[model samples]
Target: MLKKYKDDQEFYSLVGIKPQTFYKMLEILKIAESKQKYYGGRKNKIVIEGRLLMTL
Candidate 1:
């Protein structure tokens, strides 16, 4: 299930979730361990990256 892209915004757009909710879901998935670098930005992009990783 490896994603074909590197942008998280694309992923969230495909999944239809708000950026905040997507971050929460990633936290619940236990994959937000290194989140400091991802704070304060278009989080949809970050979420997409996480989603791609999850798929992998």
Candidate 2:
């Protein structure tokens, strides 16, 4: 299992990505949600926004 990361910087460190690269990755991956598509991909929640979310 991976440790939960609270901030973008920490997440960047864990994933070994540069700031620019991380933003690019987020865009390309389509996991970081927009308001409209949030419900459509409910099961695909990620820790991108500092929420202590987990799947039950």
Give lDDT per model, in order: 0.56, 0.52
Candidate 1 least-lDDT 10 residues: 36-45
lDDT of 1 at 15: 67
Query: Residue by residue across 1-56, what tens digits does model 2's lDDT show?
Result: 34556876987666666556655655644554565476675654455422322211
lDDT of 2: 0.52
Among residues 3 or more apart in sequence or in different chains, the pairs in candidate 2 whose N, CA or C atoms overlap within 3 Å are none
- For model 1, how does the per-residue alpha-carbon lDDT over 1-56 read when each residue is reduced to its tens digit? 23453576876677676556755666666545346445654435455455645564
| Candidate 2 residue 24 C-alpha distance from true site, Å | 0.2
Off by over 4 Å in 2: 1-14, 31-42, 47-56
Predicted structure 2: clash tally: 0
Say which candidate scores most in TM-score.
Answer: 2
Q: Positional deviation of 41 in candidate 1, in angstroms?
A: 34
Off by over 4 Å in 1: 1-14, 31-56
Model 1 misses residue 39 by how many Å? 30
